[model samples]
Structures are given as C-alpha cells and as structure tokens.
Target: MSTGQVLDQVMDIDEVDLTVDTEVDVNCISKHRSKVHQHFTKIENKFQCNHCKKTFNIEKYGCTSNRLKHLNSKHPSKVEKDQTHALTQKNVILQAFQKQQKNQSEADLQRLITRFIILTDQPFVITEAQSFFELMAFGKTNAPAIPSADTIRRKIFAVYDEEKLKISQKLQSAPGKISLGADCWTAATGKSFHGILASWIDADWNFQQVGLDFDILNGNHKGKSLAASMFKVMNEYGIASKLMAITTDNASNTDTMFLELQKILSEN
Candidate 1:
C-alpha cells in the first residue's frame, strides 16, 4: 500500500495518533513565532543611530555596544553635556548641604551666647561675642580669628567696675574695725607700684578683704609719697581713723611709711 494511504488508515484505526500529530504542529509553530517576536521587539526598543538618525534593530547589535559605537563615532558633544549635567547636580547638592550645616552652626552659637549671658551675668562686646562663639563652635583648642584687644579690655573693665560698685556698697554697711594693709612692688613694665588693701573681721572673726587699690608711682618708692596715697585712699573711704591696725611684709620703706602715717594721724 502507499504511505499516505497507510497513515490515513492508521489514524482512522486510532484517534490518539491524530491528536498527537496536531499537538506537535501547534508547539512547533509557537516556538518559531516566539523567536521572531523576540527579535522584532528588541529591534523596536533600540535607540536611533546618532550619525545617520536612522532606526536600527538591537537584536543584531546590543544596546550598550551600539551606544558606545555611536559615542566614539559622532556623539561626543552629547556625552560631554550629560557628564557636565551630572557634575552640576552633584555640586548643587553639596552646596545646599553646606549651607544647611552653616545655618545649624549659627543657631548653636546663638544658643550658647544666650546661656553664657544668663550664667555669668556679664554682657559681651560684639567682638568678644564673636570670638567666644568661634571657640565654642570650632573647639577650645582651635585658634580664633584675630580681634581687637582693646575692645575686649573695655568690656572686661565695664563688668569689673560694676562688680566693684556692688562690693563697695556691701563693705560700707559691714560693721567692725577694718585693718589696713599696704605693699610696694615693681611692675613688669618697669613701673613702681603701691597697693593698699582693706580687711575686716566678720561675725565669725575671720579677716576678709573689703577693698583694694593700686597706685602707679612713676618709679618713686618714697615713704612720704606712699603714705600720702594711702591717706588719700583712707580719707576717700571715710575709714582713716576706723582702722584698728596696719600690717606689712617687713619692708623698711613700708615701716617708715607706717611711722609717718601714724604721726599724720596723731596730728589730725
């Protein structure tokens, strides 16, 4: 018999043979069509050729490889612009972060200044305040920007003067005979100096310093001049006769001055 006739006869004898043939044909068609669709889809998604402005299939050439070829051939300016844009974005982000950090630092400095004023009860000049903020912001060991020493000196002097006034008022009200102490020394600047200190016995009977003064002697250490300055200080404080006794560190010049001071007081 002929092969076609024999196959038909076999199919007619068993329907299962016909069903197997149909299944095989369907699977074969699906595989063939699937490969074609994949190839065309890749081609459709590919970038246009930079030199020719032509569309090409990436199935034959990979996307990255094709882009590299285009850059080397014709799109150098486009690549440069992309790189520049990325760098610019990065720089912008960095600058913004720095500005945010700077603002936070300023806020911290202001808070610290406020706390210092409250704790110390002292007012700071603008330059001193700036220096203090810099120290706190950077570190205690960090070198500060140069500031005018005169300005800092003025602020310190003002605070000291105010404190001195308060202390003097307290001393005026304190009861008891205050002792007077005097001394002389040469300053580092080669100037002769005389210092007078007032001390009082408190309720507990311990001597406490109540007032002090330093006089620049212009290189003179004479007993008379030192005694005159001491008397002036005592008279100003209305305590010339109120001193119970005077103390010194065994200097001959101070002993002579004390003897002169006693004679002056006796005559007065």
Candidate 2:
C-alpha cells in the first residue's frame, strides 16, 4: 500500500462539518497525502511542485494525483519503490505529525487550565492538588506536566493583559459612543473592588461589551472616590470624550458620582 493509503487508515480521514470544533488540517487532508505534501509547497489555493515550480489545484478532497503523475514521469529516479524504505519514510512523517500533535495538545491543556483557575476564582495552587494530577492522568498514559503555581499565575496575568489589549483595540474602533456600567462590591475577604463594563456597537452593527476594569478600590467607595477610579479606567482606554452615557444603581452616591464626573470631564 502507498504511504497515503496507510496514513488514511491510521488517521481515519472522514468528511466533517467546518462549523464543528475540529482540527481541519489534521482531519481534512486529502487522503492523508502527507508524502505528496512533503514534496510540494502550498501556494494559496494550490500546491506548487518543488522540482518544477508548477502549481496544481487540489481536487475536492485534497487529491494529489496530478503531482504524483508529474513526479513519476519527470522525476522517476526520486521515487523509492522498496517497501522497507517506504515504511521508514512513512514512520518519519507520522513521527513529525505526532510531535506537532503533542505540542498542540500541550498548548490547549494550558489554556484550559488557565481558564478553569480564572473562571472559578480558584487559587493557582489548585494545579498542585493530588486530585488535579490524577484527573490529568485519568485517560492518558503520559499526561502533560502541570504548570507550577507561579507559572499559572504568570499565564493568568498574561492572558488578562492580552484580552485587555483586544478590548482596548475594539473600543478604539467602535463606531458609536461607548456606554459604561459600573458596580462596586466587597469580596469575602472584606477587600472592596470596582468593576466597569463598556458596551458599544461595532462597525459591523454587532453589539459588543467588555470589562474595562476590575480593580481594587483604593480608599473609599464614595461618589468622588468612585468617580476618580472610573475616570482612570476611561482615560486608560482614551474613551472619556466618547462617553455616551453612564449607568449605575439609583443611589444617592451615584448621583454625586455623575456630578463629579461631569466636572472632571469639563476640566479636561
């Protein structure tokens, strides 16, 4: 059997919906033609032969018969016929794919771990639990190494910063005025924090919302104090001038907060 046929059996290539969560590259390759792929360079919608620099369109499912015919007719000497060498070459390709799959799986595991810790408000040390290790080892023989508490902390902060950057860019490009809603609450530890959310319609007419700030309230939760903190968040995103409206609970402090914000806006 050809290397492509063997790869098809190993990977079990099947037609799948693109809408579903799937690795299109691994599962959608035409007939598992990694052997042909190794000799050709992909150029946009076509693959270019490395030897002749001629490009060919991929048939419906990634068929590379034209490329194979070219190689057989024009580069016959390069084609190996010995089954033993063909098997070794197949192993090499499979090993490359295995290494790539391992790296990809490791990255996905890290992201899942990061999201679990952040969304659950769990401590970074949760990754160090015996149960966590056993859970990772449940199905797989060789589970990827769990990151240390410090590593998890770093990853969390990195993700936070990266997401914040995305939100900032979106806010900058929003088509209409950005509306803001803010609330303050005390955590179980008695430490107070204020969260501000900004919402706006994008150029595509899609409504978008993002948390601009969720930081510790330094001094007091009074109107002036809250106004000061909110101002900083708006200024950081450079959206103070584009503010369409502000929303907060109907409290005496909120009325005072708006008044103070208006004064601050005028002074700027």
Best by TM-score: 2
Question: For candidate 2, lDDT tens digit of each residue in 72-145?
Answer: 88767656542355777667556655554465466677888999999999999999999988887664444467
The worst-scoring run of ten residues by lDDT in candidate 1 lies at 31-40
Model 1: how far residue 233 lies from native, Å: 2.9
Query: For model 1, what is the C-alpha lDDT against the true structure?
Result: 0.58
The segments of candidate 1 whose C-alpha lies over 4 angstroms from its true place after superposition are 1-148, 204-206, 259-268
User: For each candidate, what TM-score against the reference?
Assistant: 0.44, 0.55
What TM-score, to 2 decimals, does candidate 2 have? 0.55
Instruction: Tell me, by lDDT, which candidate is best.
Output: 2
lDDT string, candidate 1, 161-184, tens digits: 776677566556557877888888
lDDT of 2 at 245: 91
Q: C-alpha displacement of 173 in model 1, angstroms?
A: 1.8
Candidate 1 backbone overlaps, count: 0
Q: Flag clash pairs in model 2.
A: none
